[model samples]
Target: MTVFVDTSAFLAYLDRSDENHETAVATWTQLLHNRELLVCTNYILIESSALIQNRLGMAAIRDFQELFIPLLRIEWIDESVHQTGVAAWLAANRRRLSLVDVTSFETMRRLFINTAFAFDQHFVEQGFSCLK
Candidate 1:
């Protein structure tokens, strides 16, 4: 089973101060060891880079890339995905979900994915099972 990894998981993995860091590391270790499938979207990739650079510095980001790059199967986000994200945002009744969340959801749906290594409650509320 492949999982759509979210930016939150990446942040946790990079930030030792985060309460969820261990969970993220443990989950990623399992994925990297061929115990499970791992997937990421362009949105998460870009977000992770920015976050890592800001919080942990470029050196740490490079370390993260070295560790995660070979194990992850990255999927690109496209124009149609943006349209779908906008539609989801506009149709929502009360939830204040962001385009990132919508993009993740759209990509997951398109890829026939049902789970994510996410700490975002929005993902779980929308029916995707989270790692924690």
Candidate 2:
């Protein structure tokens, strides 16, 4: 199965202090053991890298890059995906909802991916099943 990895899950897995760290680690291990195909959009990579660098320092970012990044099959966002995500974000009209998240939803829909390895409730709210 292909699981969409989100920024929240990346943060949780990388930061030991994060509240969801333990669960994220366990889920990550299981996914890897099962050889599940992990995927993420370029948007998630950018968001995760920035957050990891800001909160955990360069070492953590290196770990994310060297250790975890290789396991992912990145889905690069294009003009069409960006435009659709922006449209979804506007239609949602929720301030707390992010454009990256709406784009993730669109990406998942386009890929026919039903599950996500994410800590964000927005994934579930958007009708996607979350691993954690």
Best by TM-score: 2
The global Cα lDDT (0 to 1) of model 1 is 0.85
Task: Give residue 92's lDDT in candidate 2 (0 to 100).
Answer: 89
Q: Which residues of candidate 2, in runs, are more than 4 Å off?
A: none
lDDT of 1 by residue, 1-132 (tens): 889889898889889999999988898877667667788887888888988999999988898789876778888888999888888887884566877788889889899899999888889888999986
Local accuracy of candidate 2 as per-residue lDDT tens digits, 1-132: 999999999999989999999999999999999999999999999999999999999999999999999989999999999999999899989999999999999999999999999989999998999998
- Each prediction's total of clashing residue pairs, residues at least 3 apart in sequence or on different chains, is 0, 0
Which segments of candidate 1 are over 4 A away from where they belong?
93-96
**Candidate that would win on lDDT:** 2
Could you report the Cα RMSD, in angstroms, for every candidate shown?
1.8, 0.6
Show the colliding residue pairs in model 1: none
